[model samples]
Target: MKILIIEDEEGLRESIAEYFTEAGNICETAASYSMALTKVELYRYDCILLDITLPGGGDGISILKKLKENNYTDGVLIISAKNSLDDRLQGLDLGADDYLVKPFHLSELKARVSAIIRRKMYNGSNLLLFNELSIDLQAKTVKVHDTSVKFTRKEFDLLIYFIANKGKVVSKNAIAEHLWGDGIDIADNFDFIYSHIKNIRKKLVEAGGNDYIEAAYGMGYKFTGK
Candidate 1:
């Protein structure tokens, strides 16, 4: 899963990022409200870890308002030191899916993040089916007709993202953000996306799965699942 950690505490932010990255997921961080806002407006993430208090761009409440104003549908999990009832209510009212009080266990944090992602992406289903293709959300593995098919990290991520929005034309920009998070310079027309998709297609086809990904002329690519 792709995650963006919006926290001002540098140490905590790095810890969260490192923890998630080590778990084989793309993770990014923003130290202030401005950076977080810029990231929200420019890219997409499977889950966003928001902190209520920020140095710039007002506070996390305002950031939540901005996200709603933009109609961003991504999952949001607020992580704040403030444990006040009103603060939690306000954050929830503003569209945060989950709230985690600071000084909490990283294991719990991981579990909450995983819950949000599962709810958002798979509707709590670990198995994702697209014809003969199958994806195990919890295990991060793929199978074709019940036969396991190996995939690189990025390749697996891209395949799931494509299948989730199957039949929709997803632009290159969206693909880059979902797979690489804020790590890649997306404005530079990174060509590695094609290579990744190419490899995924080749692997699936070799494993007795159909090529569900279709190029949408000059616009983007579509997962025309059979």
Candidate 2:
């Protein structure tokens, strides 16, 4: 999954980014409100870890309001030191999926973010089913008619991204940014993406699964399965 960490504290932000990245996720960090705002405006993430107190001009609430106003469907989990009832209520009312207090365990944060993403993408289900494909989100496993299919971490992530945005023509740049965070300089070439797509298509087809991914010529690719 792609995650954005919007926290001012360098230590905590780095910790969160490292943890998520180690777990086969694309992570981007923003220390100030302005940086966070720029990231939110430019990219879409599976979930965003927001810190209420920011160093720049606006607070995290303003970012939340911006996301809501723009109607972005990104899952938001607010992580703040302020544990007041009013703050929690206000964030929830403003459209945050979940909230965690500061100094919390990284495991707890991961669990909460996983839950939020699962709800948003899989309707709170651990198993994601599409046609003959059955994916176990928790296990990070995929099966086609009970026969397991092996996928590398990147392949697996790309498959899920395509499934989540099924029927939409996802641009190459979007796919690259989603797989590798915006911080990376991989936008100049799409050879890596083509290799992964080729592998995923071959594996799925060999496993008796339908070929649902279609290239959109100069545009991008789309998961056209119904």
Candidate 3:
């Protein structure tokens, strides 16, 4: 999943980012409110870990407000040190999916983020079904009919992203940004995207699954699922 960590505490922010990234997630971070706002406005994430207090203009609440104002559906989990009922109520009322009080365990945070993403994408279920495909979100496994198909971390993530947005055209730039955030300095080439898609298609067809992905001419690729 793609995650945005909006916290000003350097140590806490780094720890969260490291934990999420190690679990095969793309993580972007902001040390201040301005940076957080810029990221939320410019990109989308599966979840946003927001801190209520921030330096430089607006606070986390304002960022949450912006997301609601723009009707962004990204799951939000307010990770604030403030454990006051008022703060929690305000965050939830403004549209945060969950609230995690500060001084919490990383495991708990992971669980909350997973739950939010699951609720948003799969209606709170861990299994995702499309045609003959059965995806076990918690196990990070995929099966076609009764045959198990193995996928590398990135391949698996790309597959989930595709299936989640099935039937919609997804641009190469958007895919790249989602997988490797705006921080990475990869060279200006999208051959890697084609290669991954080709691999996915090959694996699915070999496993008696339908070829759901299609290149949309000069635009990008679309998972038609048809």
Candidate 4:
């Protein structure tokens, strides 16, 4: 999952980002309201960890309003030191899916974020089914028909990307960005992505799964549920 953490505290922001990154999430941080606004305008996130108190002149609720105005209907989780009932109610009124008070456990935050994403995007279901294949997002397990299929980390990430953007032309760059973030240089990532895709395809086929990935020459791959 892609997440944006908007927090002014350097240590807290980094800690949250690192924890989520280790949990197979693409995380980005913004230390100020302006920076967070720019990121929200530029990229789409599965969930946003927004801090109600911002260093800049603007408030986090303003950002949420702008996102709603711009049709960004993704899950938004508010994180702040403001724990009053009024604050929580106001945040929810501004469209926050959940509220996490400061000094909370990272594990709890992760669980809440996952729940919000599942509710918003997956209809409160953890299992993502495509054809005869099923992926348990919470369990990080994949099954072909009724049997379990083992997969490497890369293979699982690739599959999740394909499933998330099902029936869409997923460019090599998109896959790379989703999997590796800004670490790998784009020119050097095509071969690696192809190899991962090849391995995932081979493993699924060997597991008695139908092929749903189609390659588009000079373009990208598409998951058509074929």
Residues 1-226, candidate 1: write the lDDT tens digits.
Answer: 8899999998999999999999999998888888888888888788999999998857889888988999998899999999999999999999999999999888999999989888887887788877897788888889899789998888988998898788899998889878877666645775888999899889989999899889998889999855
Better of 1 and 3 by lDDT: 3
Q: Write model 4 residue lDDT over 33-131, tens digit each, in one string.
A: 999998888777789999999977898989989888898877899999998999899889878999999889999999999999999877899998888
The 10-residue segment with the lowest total lDDT in model 3: 179-188
lDDT of each: 0.88, 0.94, 0.92, 0.87
Note the residue pairs that clash in candidate 4. Answer: none
Give the range of the ten consecutive residues with the poorest summed lDDT in model 2.
Answer: 181-190
- Give all TM-scores, in the order shown: 0.94, 0.97, 0.97, 0.88
Tens-digit lDDT track for model 2 on 1-226?
Answer: 8999999999999999999899888999999999999999999999999999999899999999999999999999999999999999999999999999988999999999999998998999999999999999888999999899999999999999999989999999899889888755745688989999999999999999899999999899999878
- RMSD in Å for all candidates: 1.6, 1.0, 1.0, 2.3
| Residue 54 of model 1, lDDT score | 92
TM-score of 1: 0.94
Stretches off by above 4 angstroms in model 3 are none
lDDT of 2 at 50: 96
Residue 65 error for model 2, in Å? Answer: 0.6
Any idea how many clashes model 3 has?
Answer: 0
TM-score of candidate 4 on Cα atoms, chains taken together:
0.88
Per-residue lDDT of candidate 3, residues 91-148 (tens digit) = 9999999998889999999999999999999989999988899999989999999999
